[model samples]
Target: MQHRPIKTAVFPVAGQGTRFLPATKAVPKEMLPVVDKPLLQYAVDEALAAGIERLVFITARGKGAIDDHFDMASELVAGLKARGKTAELASLEGTCLEPGRITSIRQQEPAGLGHAVWCARHIVGADAFAVLLPDELLWNPARPALAAMHDAYRQMGGNIISVLEVTEAHTHRYGIVTPGRSDGLLTEVRGMVEKPQVGTAPSRLAAIGRYILQPEVMDVLAKGRRGAGGEIQLTDAMAELIGVQPFHALTFEGTRFDCGDKVGHLMANVALALERSDTGPALRDWLRSLEL
Candidate 1:
């Protein structure tokens, strides 16, 4: 059977970045820069690279800056053009979404991941769409992570989620998956346990932020049942779709940073900076000089 092509992607950016505190008071956490570009930009670029033609952003009241970020900065572009800053001008390329390719809908309240995703139901309609959480930044420029999952979706023809092995001690921090039939990086997902209790956890393979879900998930979320943390959890909705549809997890080949945490954010910057030819030498020198 041919799989429904994933032409649209939903970005759930409505969360209040309470973890970042005062810095996120005025800015959305997704707007926080990794090196120079904001976290949201990386997620958008990844979606576009994976052949996603339309972007559906689930945002809240304070996320207007995100809307502005994707809009063309005419004055700034003119300034760079006059100065003949060719490189800078080139850097801004591919930042703007063409015409009607992007849509943003408000969540209205701080519900949860499932609720945030449900906000884009009308826009997503009845198509298979990918969901990317900007907080999870997967670094693999050679082949974008989402593209890999899309490839698996074509072969497997079901819901595909990105998974990574975490230590047993950290199992409770993520949505743990029960492994079934395994084939290299791809594993058949028997079930998913959201933030399982430490001792009772199923497996070490934890689900990450990437997902290619069928439209039936919206129907599950419509039930409005609250799960862990007393909020509507996306994992809960996904679990409902497991038996009804083919569900599998892909161990994405890449370095994933949980940018939602302070340490992870810092690590992403240092790691990406070290990979840049221009900044690597200076950054390496500075790091070596530090007395840790």
Candidate 2:
């Protein structure tokens, strides 16, 4: 079946980063820096790398910083250019989107992931779209995780979700997928249970933050039925499409860090910092000297 091209992606960033406390009180969690770039920028770059043309950000109140982050910093760029800061100016490349290529919609309230995604339904309009959570930072620059999912979507053409094998004990923390047929990284999704009760999970394969969903799922979320945690869980909506639509999970190839958690956020920064040429040597040396 020929599928509509996946040209757009939805980023659900409306959540208040209560986890980060004082730091997030003034800034959106998505705007928190990983190493040098903010968390949201990494997700945007991944989407762009996957040939996504339009970016739909589901934002909430006080999230205007995200919109400003993507806007061209005219004064900053001019200052760098005047000072002959070619390197700084070059680093800003690809940060700004083509006018009209990006759009932001307000979530208004702290709804669940499903509602946040549904907010972009009008903007997405009949096209298969991707939803990327800024919290799950996949560290695979050479072949972005989303790009890999896009490749699978082109071949399978239904609903593609990125999965990772988490420990059985940790199944309750994620939306676990029951495997049907396996073909290396691609597995037929038999079913999904959002944060299933302990010892009740079917499999250890859990859905991460990346998803390429068909537009029909929007109608399902439109019902506004609450699921786990009293939020309109996207997993519940996607589960409904499993038998009706072709749903498959791709075992993503990369190290994923859940930056929503404090420890995970720190790990991402240290890992990325260690990979940087400018900081790697010094950071590695400092690490080697650690008492722990």
Candidate 3:
């Protein structure tokens, strides 16, 4: 039997993005544009393509602009109309969402990823909700990672997390899930260890920032203690749910960009730009001529 359809997704965007410094001083990191679109837009677009009917953002005090981005810009619309830019106007119209479709909850504290997700409990209620980390952008998949997990969730009938193989030496950077025998692309998760020591990790299949979690996780998050980095790590709560539920790790095929990091952000731009037919040749020529 297919599991319940995932109709809503939670995006955690409250953290103070200190890594980007002055750029993030006033502007939210989620608003940082990757090429032409902000990082958050890519995530929102991805979610929408994944059949997510509603979006719940866990935001803090300084995230008003994010809400505004999706709202229609009246003045811009007027100018586009005057210019007869029908295509651009239509794109903007498409971006405007019904107010009720999007909701926000205040995290109040910079607790952790777990806390951010927990804040959405009232909104998520008892349904299985997909979680998408706005900073992780995937490119050119027929569906986003969350959608892939949604498919896995439907088939597996349990909690599903997106997993990707990372360099074993860099395993500490993610929550690694130990794998058992795999049935096609989904692997049976024997256990998950967050940032395990190098060479001691059970598997290099680390959890990407995508999840299709049961509502029971909210209770676990409520009781979860502070873990790595002195924050309420979501991995801890997920770890607790492993044995209780049929947690599985899905190996999704796609190019994922870590837009959260400065270097990764640049890489996403380069990779995406090269894929655009109009810009590909020009960008290729420019890269070929660059003297390293």
Worst 10 residues of 1 by lDDT: 1-10
Clash-forming residue pairs, model 2: none
In order of lDDT, best first, we have 2, 1, 3
Model 3 gets an lDDT of 0.86
lDDT of 1 by residue, 1-292 (tens): 3587788899999988999999999999999998888999999999999999999999987899999999999999999999999999988876796889999999998889999999988988878999999999999999888999999999999899999999999999988998899999999999998999988888999988999999899999999999999989999999988888999999989899999999999999999999999889999999999999
TM-score of each: 0.98, 0.99, 0.95
Candidate 1: C-alpha lDDT: 0.92
Q: Model 2 — TM-score against the truth? A: 0.99
Better model by lDDT, 2 or 3? Answer: 2
| Whole-model lDDT per candidate | 0.92, 0.94, 0.86
lDDT score of residue 48 within candidate 1:
92
Best by lDDT: 2
lDDT of model 1, residue 171:
95
When 1 and 3 are scored with TM-score, the better candidate is 1
Lowest lDDT sum, 10 consecutive residues, model 2, at 89-98
Better of 2 and 3 by TM-score: 2
